[model samples]
Target: MEKLHKPKKVFVPGAISPQFIADSIAKHQSKVNIGAHAIFLGQIRADEKAEGFVTGIEYSAYEEMAEQTFHEIREDAFSKFDLICMHIYHSIGLVPTGEISLFVFVSSGHRRAAFEASEYIVEQIKTKVPIFGKELVGPAGEYIWKENK
Candidate 1:
């Protein structure tokens, strides 16, 4: 695996900030050939559970397997689409409500390919990766493990 693919670091300790996302887009401005860029941001929302309102989420993952899975997904996306570039970031640890936990960016020369590739990568990550999360609910610090449905 080391020779085949050097995995890029994907997990951030906390929430991904708006500034970071803006900075990433700004950095790609020099690549004038890229006509379309699609971005997917997974945000933690305060959902009303049967017990109470879910306040936040604590994410965890089987790191080694997840990294390998991500690499495979990236390769598959590149092979399927005419993409300029793609980057995926997922948050680990605690993320408060209204914060972003996952960021998937895809760039291409055309809009359709960019959109399709982005959606494909995101769905693959959600279903294929070994990442797990627990929904932190109520005022008493109770939590319920979440499934990637």
Candidate 2:
């Protein structure tokens, strides 16, 4: 396994704008000799369940732990794959239904590495991070946090 590098910044906040993420990626491109860029956007879904309709989502995280985990993930991605650069951002607090919950972007010198690294970053986020999210449902809604599968 390759050593991981920490991202320049990581935050667990109330909301995030897609434009902000795009801007951040643009800033990182200066030294990136990237020929390919791939991105993954995760949106909150309104799920209809036996109980009722899921209206929105609220996210939370162990920030210190998540950042450390994210740093390791970044380092591993750089060492294992030939990526020029990569970024990951996730929303915290109350994210309205249908809004984006997470964003992962990867850039590389070639198409293959960008695509692969994009997938790797997301998979690592889902399985390794200490972030948690709760699903809010119905008028008298209940909040359900995600459990590891």
Candidate 3:
């Protein structure tokens, strides 16, 4: 059996911050070889429910399984696309409706690979990961289990 690459940490304790994102981008400025970058940020939405309106999302996951799935997704993307860099971060706790819960970044020598890889990574995460969310709604703080649409 071939050895799999060790999984990197993909889960954050809370919402992904704008400053962290900005710093990530700024760090890549030194990589002159990268010509194109694609970024995707998944924000918690204020979707109206029958009981109330969504104020935030409380996220949870099977950490071990999710990490392995993430590693596989990364490997598949690298094999399928000529990517120079890729990152995936997901919130593991409460993230306000306007705050970012997920962040995906991909880079390549050209635009197409970066864009395609970015999309692929996001789609794979949505479909394959074991992450779950509880949508915290309204003033009463009632929550409904969220399903990916």
Task: Using TM-score, give the best candidate's number.
Answer: 3
Task: For candidate 1, give the lDDT of residue 38.
Answer: 96
Model 3, residue 65: C-alpha shift (Å): 0.7
Worst 10 residues of 2 by lDDT: 1-10
Deviating ranges (above 4 Å) for candidate 1: 1-6
lDDT of 3 by residue, 7-108 (tens): 689999999999999999999999999999999999989999998899999999999999988999988888889988888999998999999999999989
Q: Looking at model 1, how many pairs of residues clash? A: 0
For model 2, residues 1-149, the per-residue Cα lDDT tens digits are: 45545355666476668778768777866765778888898887788866677787787888888888888888888887898778778888888777777888888889999988888888998899888878887778888765444
Considering summed lDDT, which 10 consecutive residues are worst modelled in model 3?
Answer: 1-10
Q: Rank the candidates by TM-score, best first.
A: 3, 1, 2
lDDT, each prediction: 0.90, 0.79, 0.92
All candidates: TM-score: 0.94, 0.87, 0.96
Could you report the Cα RMSD, in angstroms, for every candidate shown? 1.9, 2.2, 1.3
- After superposition, the stretches of candidate 3 with alpha carbons farther than 4 Å from their true spots are 1-5
Poorly placed runs, candidate 2 (over 4 Å): 1-7, 28-32, 147-149
